[model samples]
Target: MTLSVSLQHAFPGVSLDVRFDAPQGVTALFGRSGSGKTTVVNAVAGLLRPDQGRITLGDRVLFDAAQRQNLAPHRRRIGYVFQDARLFPHLSVRQNLLYGRWFAPKAARRAEFDRVIEMLGIAALLDRRPGLLSGGEKSRVALGRALLSEPDLLLMDEPLAALDEARKAEILPYLERLRDTFALPILYVSHSPAEVARLATTVVMLEAGQVTIAGPAHEVLADPTGARGFGQREAGALITARVSDRQEDGLTRLDCGAGPLWLPGITAPAGAALRLQILARDVMLARTRPEGISALNILEAEIQDIVAADGDGSAVLVRLQLAPGAGDKTAPEILLARITRRSVSALSLAPGLRVFAVIKSVAVAPGAVGPQAI
Candidate 1:
């Protein structure tokens, strides 16, 4: 399913004018607070009408200003998951999940109740009430309820915002499963770079009510020039890898285009595909391969591009193409390094220069890794 949106809405100090296509899988609307992320979501859900625009999901027209067509929220067939679970406190978990069925027509209900419960791992909590559930548990139940509705698309508005780090970690796997297992497209709203790096297939970056960048998650995140939006410290590269083997020293080896990356013990099976987020700030560049170093990851890379330093001129962002074979014109894999401007001048770094990107094995956080689609 594809969701195309062209919207223009205005308020006292905010005027939103944006257009983007959300393809199947998770399309994350990413930006800071009050970036009109939720406004765009609301326009899709029919909760807020645009001053001028059109929203089409596949063949169905959800809103069209020219035609004066607007579907009611209930009739739009889009499941919404908010930051708060919004489950009925008095109702049992099962009851809360089943309640979504009330809005879904009998003939259109395609999501199996038992399957949703199992997918979200909420079968154990079915008999309990929302008041007694943990934050993670409530989010799962809420997700189950949304899935049970059998909507054409899913709208998630920062679903993890209300959870603490532990709860957020607890619920991330379920969300990943939802993306991998379901056919429905998801329009997810979040400001978190880590979440966007892990969950998003497509990222539409909004700033001050406008889309500053829109493209594949990896490409958008890898742009050194776009680092300001994500904050220099949080900017990074996303790499696709497969769990190749586990070592006795308590590390899981992943095979990527750049070769093996040994991370802290990953519980997934050897063949599982995973996505890893490597922060630019954690990477160090070397003109010559350094030996006898504690860092386990050092890949041969060529300078692809160098972005000018920020206002303070204290740092420079460099893009590196990793594992470029002999006579190979295109580098399929890339890594990012943020270093001092003085280092750039000292090494005389320029495009096409060969260098090594050194990364510490322990620098990668467990939360920055997640399952990728096979």
Candidate 2:
């Protein structure tokens, strides 16, 4: 399924002019609080009407101001999960989930009730009430309710925003499973880089009521020029890897384009695909391979580009392409490094120059790793 949106709306302080196509998998509408991320999602959900342009899900036209066509929210065949669970306070979890089936046409309700419960791991909570469930449990139940609706597309407006770190961690795996198991296309709204890095396949970056960037999540996040959108400190690269082995010392070895990377506290079985985030701030660039270093991860890389120092002129961002070893040229990967302007000048770094990216094995926290795309 595909979602196409082109909208124009003007409010007091925000004027939104956005256009993008969200293919299968999660497409994250990412930006700050007032960046119009929710506005775009509301438009898609048929909750807010745009003054102009069109919105289409596959062949269905949800909105077209020029054509004088607009589908009411209930008729749009779209499921919405908000920041809050929004479950019926008096209803049991089972009843709350089954409530969605009432909106789906009998012929269109093909999503099995039991399957959604299993997928979201909410079967055990069926007899419980919203007040009795934890934040993560509530979110899962909310997700289950939405999935059971049998919508063509799912819209989540920062569903995890209200949760704390532990609660968010408890729910991420279920979200990943939903993405991989279902054919449903998700339009997810989030400002957290970690959430987007973990869940998004496509990323649409909005700034001040406009789309500043939209593309593959990895490319958009790794773009040297787009560091400011994601925040300088949070800027980083995503690597697709597979767990190759678990050492007796309690570290997991992953094989990627950059060769083997050792990470602590990873319990995924060998051969499991994973996505790892390497934050630019945690990387160090060296002109030559430094011997006898405490850092356990060093990869031969070539400078692809150098972003000039930020507004404060305190640091520079460097983009590097990992060089594949002999007889292995198919795998390609990119890494980003944030360093002082003085270091850039001292090393005389430039595009095409060979260097080593020094990374501490423990720098990649457990939260930075996620299940890879199936």
Highest TM-score, which number?
2
Clashing pairs in 2: none
Give the TM-score (vs. native) of candidate 1. 0.97
Which regions of candidate 2 are displaced past 4 Å? Answer: 329-331
RMSD per prediction, one decimal? 1.7, 1.1
Give each model a TM-score: 0.97, 0.98
Tens-digit lDDT string for candidate 2 (1-374): 89999999999977899999999999999999999999999999888989999999999999999999999999899999999999999999999999987878899777589888888888889999999999999999999888888889999999999999999999999999999998978999999999998999998999998888899888987787656688877888888888999999988899887688989989899999999889999999999899987898889999998886378887888998998866666657888999998898999999999999999998999998999977
Each prediction's Cα lDDT score?
Answer: 0.90, 0.90
Pairs in clash, predicted candidate 1: none
Number of backbone collisions per candidate, in order?
0, 0
